[model samples]
Each structure stands twice: as structure tokens, then as C-alpha cells.
Target: MKQLKSFIKKEFFHIFRDPRTMLILFGIPVVQLLVFGTVIKSEIKDVHIAIYDQSKDETTKEITNKLLSSGYFILDENLNNLDGIDAIFRKGKVREVIVFENNFGQTLGKEGTAKMQLIADASDPNIAKLAISYTTAIVNDYIRKLYPEMQLPMQITPEVRMYFNEEMKSAYMFVPGVMALILMLISAMMTSISITREKELGTMEILLVSPLRPVQIIVGKVLPYLLLSIANAFIIVLIGHFVFSVPVNGSFILLMLETILFILMALCLGILISTAAKNQMTAMFISMIGLMLPTILLSGFIFPIENMPVVLQYFSHIMPARYFITIVRTIMLKGTGIFFIWKETAVLIAMTLFFIAVSVRKFKIRLE
Candidate 1:
């Protein structure tokens, strides 16, 4: 009994002494709690919307005010004409556009009914559906509150048009996200494990001392995976387009270029991870735990990022998957070209350069 107790105490001391163990035991739980608790929200908030009120009547103004004030939406633009609706949605900032027909207040007063169109950017169907529903509810609430004692039933008929994805296919949303997730995990994990395996097997020192420069060594390790990952991406896209019926409405070349950029960024990130990791297990652990969950959750893969708390939303900015998912969705669903996605493209480029710089520095330090 005494010996067993001593062994248990020694085990506890070892666990407490290892920072990684402590982090796995405690830090992960706390982070998961905070991430899950704050990130998973059924309701959408701060949804950017455009209003094209043709009537410019009192009722149209009132309904617009109600939507903007409900905390569920923010007015991104007061569009001048219906002609720009397509352009606005392609830009990806506005989620829904509310258009009130001519003489909205007058029509409601005379006929006890008015027409309003809720045209949503359904590239992200969930947000579009939620925003449309919320807008409809607010309009209904407005009619009820304004006509409590009226005998004639007043109604605002909302016609919903889900742009980009007319059928609101779930596959349309998840395919791009799944593509991002698969590429990020596979590319990053394989590259990290490959480099770390060299370190663990003591071949990294030989490579370091050999004729190859650090950049060359890194490139040599990453090149095969890069080509393989690009092939994997092509297969995924083909499957998504043919089997799942997800559209590749944009330039296929641009899509491939963006995918390559994202894959390179992910591979560079893996190299950075390898520099810090001493073994395959550690590299795998960091790749899986550090990249996977964030890619799935914070990347707006399943959950909407705007619905999350502001801090979590801001934190998601650093997640490479977030930008890639946006890029993929924009190209696949919206068919928008480089003009629409230049910012996201730039972000991925910057991340790739940053990761390469850091990984090279860290690898040199290890070589020293």
C-alpha cells in the first residue's frame, strides 16, 4: 500500500510538471468550453443587409428601422436601385437585401397589404435562412403592433429569393468547408509529421549538414506533399461538382490557384509546427488539436462566425481556414472572380509568407 501511494504521487508530480500534459488536461477544456459556449449560437446577429426601398414611404422606413434596431442586422447599404443587388451580393458583404415595392405605405393603408422582397445571399444558406426568418418575424410584429384593434387584417407578404443557391442545398455550403478542412488537415498534418519524423529519426541533422540549404531542404520535403495535396484538391472539387452537384461557376483556373495558395500556406504552417515539435506524436497532436477544431468551428464551417461573440469573431480572423472557406465559397457558389476575393487572397498570401519566414528562422535556430 505504501509503495502504491508513492508511485501515484510520483505520477501526479510528473503530470503537473509537464506543461503539455497540463495544457491537455486543463487548458484544452477551458478553451473548448469558451469556444463551444460562445461560438455555438442558434441566433444570428449583426447580419449585414441592404435595403432598396423603392417606395421610400413611411412604412418602408419603419420596417427598415425595425430590422436595423433588432440587433440581428446591420444596414450595410441603402441601395439606390435593384440593378446593383447582384453586384452587392457578389461582393459578399451584404447577407440579405430588403426591397419594398412602390408606394409601400399607401398600398398597405389602402389594400391592407404590401409587397416586400427578401433576397438573401444563399451561398451560406443557414445565415440567409435565419436572416430572412428574422426579418419576416419583425415585419409581422410590426404589423401586429401597429394594427392591434383594426378589423381589416393587415399583412406584409414577403417573397424570399435565395440568390447563388436557389434550392438552398446544404451540400453547397458544406462541400467548400469540407474541402477546406480536408486540405488543411491532410496537407498540414502530413508535412508536419514528415519533417518531424526526420527529426525524431536523427536524419534531420544529416540533412542540415548536407549540401542542401535550409529553404531547399524545406522545399524538398514539402514539394511532394504539395503536388499530392493539389491532386487531392482536384479530386475533391471534381467529386463535389459531379456527385454533390455543387457548382464551379467561377474561373476554374482561379479556383485552382487559390486552392494552391491555401495548401501552400497550410504546408508552411506545418513546417512551422515541425520546427517546434520534437517528434511525430507532438507534431500530429498540434496539427490535430490546434488546426482541426479551429478550422471546423472558428472557420465558419458549421457555425456562423458573425453569430459568435466579437472576440471570437476577431480571433477567427487569424484562422487560415476562415479565409480559404470564404474564397472557396465565393468562387464555387457566387462565381465571383479575383475582384471579389482579392482581400481574402491577399490574406492567404500574407499568411503563407509569414509562416515561411517563421519556419525558416526556427529551422535555422534548430540547425545552430
Candidate 2:
């Protein structure tokens, strides 16, 4: 027991004595969290819109006000004619245009029929679809409220047109998921292998001969990797924001805390793997084959869990990455709080405990 305590102390000296190692442990996770949060979002908001109101009626004006007030659209220009509509879209400031037919109010009141055209840019299909959907709902609600007394069949009509992301760009969904997978690979797998490498190289034996315990040895070895993983998380989020234009809908602090928790869980798993591995190559192979592939294929990161075969869906339950991805997505994209994700967090905590328990048992056996 005394020898084990001495060994852990020496390991701390080795880890804290190296600044580069320390930075990597802590920095990478922060970078990855930021990158994933900012770069990878599916929701669209504040899209620019133009209005070509031929009727200039009270109903059309009211509908326009609702669209702007909904906070989903920004009115960029008012077009006098269709000739300028194409040019306005070409300038790229406006993503959608709303055109009200002439005699809109008169037709709705007298003839009980009116039509409006929603022209959208189809280049980015997801945003275009959401914008059109929102616009149509707003117009329909206005029409229904205006003529609640008169119930006429097929009286109000909205014609929706789409632009950009015509296919709804499933890429938008996958990018953030991929970011999560990458961070897990780099943070958990790499750290595990690096720590095991020291053991295989005989350095761990020297530390064990010194004045430190096994726990301190493990902590010192893991601290640098933890920092690096956090840094990587931040970078992924930044790229998601500036490059992909993904929004951080949730509290930044909450997202960070969730990320850090996942990182710690992953590191614990890495330590467990290290305890099992005989060498760096073995550690790397186990981490990659055991953790990475399951994370990519089974975690519902890229594929919807509900759509998967029941057996595979059940299999995904064993994957920690699955829960981490869920936690991150809910907090970062969906803007959910602890109340929404407590179950996932609890699962992660359990997994961390399991890994630590197993690793400690293995380490003790190895020492004996």
C-alpha cells in the first residue's frame, strides 16, 4: 500500500512538470465543445425576407407585421414589381419574398377568395422549407382571424415557393454529430493509449517505484489529455458557428458543463482501457475498435435510433457516446436544461463509476 501511494505521487510529478501535456489535457475539450455548439445546428432563424404587396391592403399589411414580429424573418426590401424580385434575390440579402395579389382584400370579402405567393430561395433547402412553413402558417392564421364570421370553403389560399437546400440538407444534422464522434475519439481513445504507452515503455514502473499512489498516477496522466479534449471541443463549436452558421440556442455555461462531464466520463473509460491493454498498439486498437466504431454506427449520432433495427437500438444503449451526444445536442441545439437531461447525466455518472471501479480493480491485480 505504501509503495502504491509513492508510485501515484511520482506520476503527478511527471504530469504537472510538463506544461505542454497539461495544456493538451485541458484545452482540447473546451475547443471541441465550442466548435460543436457553434458550428453544428439544425434550426434556422432570422432569415431575410422581401415583400411585394400588389394589394397594399389591410390584411396583407397585418400578415406582414406578424411575420416580422415572429422573430423568424427580417424584412429586407419592398419590391414594386416582379422585375426587381429576381435582382433582389440575386443580391443574396433576401432568402424569401411574399407577394400579395391585387384586390386581395376585395376578393376575400366579396368573392370570399384570395391568393398570395411565397417565393423562396432553394439553395439551402432546410432554411427555405422552414421559412415557407412559418410564412404559410402566419398568413393562414391572419386570414382565419379576419374572416371568422364567414365560413367559406377554399376561400383563402397561400402558394409556397422554395429556394436553397431543396433536400433539407441532412448534412446540417450530421455535421454536429460527427463533431461529437471526433472529440470522443481524440479525447478518450487517444488519452487511454498515451497513458498505457508510458506503462509499456517501463516509465510507469519507475513511477511505481517512487512515492505516489495509483490514483494520483492515473489523475496526473489524465489531466493533460482532459485539457486538450476540452480545447478541441471549443474549436469544433467555433467552426460550427462561423463556417456553418449554426446557432447556440442554449446557455453557453450549461453546454460547457455538459461537455466537461462527458469528457471526464470518456477519460475514465480510457483509463479502464489502459488497464486492460498491454502496450500502446493494443490500447489504440482496443480504443478504436471497441469505442469508435460503436460510437459512429450505434450511437444514433448519424442515424435515428427509432429507425434502426430493434436489436441495434438496444445495443446502442450500452454506448456512452450515445448518451453524451444526446446531452450535448439537447443542451446546445435544443436549449434544454438539467430537467430535460438529468437521466442522461445520471447514466454518464454511472458509466464513469463503472469504468473507475473496473480500472482500479485491474490496476490492483496488476500490482499484486
TM-score of each: 0.61, 0.59
1-368: candidate 1 lDDT, tens digit per residue: 45344433544554467686455434543344334434544568899999998899788888888888899899988988989999999999999999999998998888888899999999988898999899988998898788776545474556879899886666777778777877887678877887887788887787778666787777766766677678778877876777667899999999999999999999999999998898999999999999998998899988899999999999999999999999999998999999999999999999999999999999889877
lDDT of 2 by residue, 123-236 (tens): 888778988988888777787788787766675555645332333444445545766676677667766777787887898787677666777777776766677667777876
Local error of candidate 2 at 233, Å? 13
In model 1, residue pairs whose N, Cα or C atoms come closer than 3 Å (at least 3 residues apart or on different chains), thus clashing, are none
Each prediction's Cα lDDT score?
0.83, 0.76
Models, CA RMSD each: 15.9, 8.3
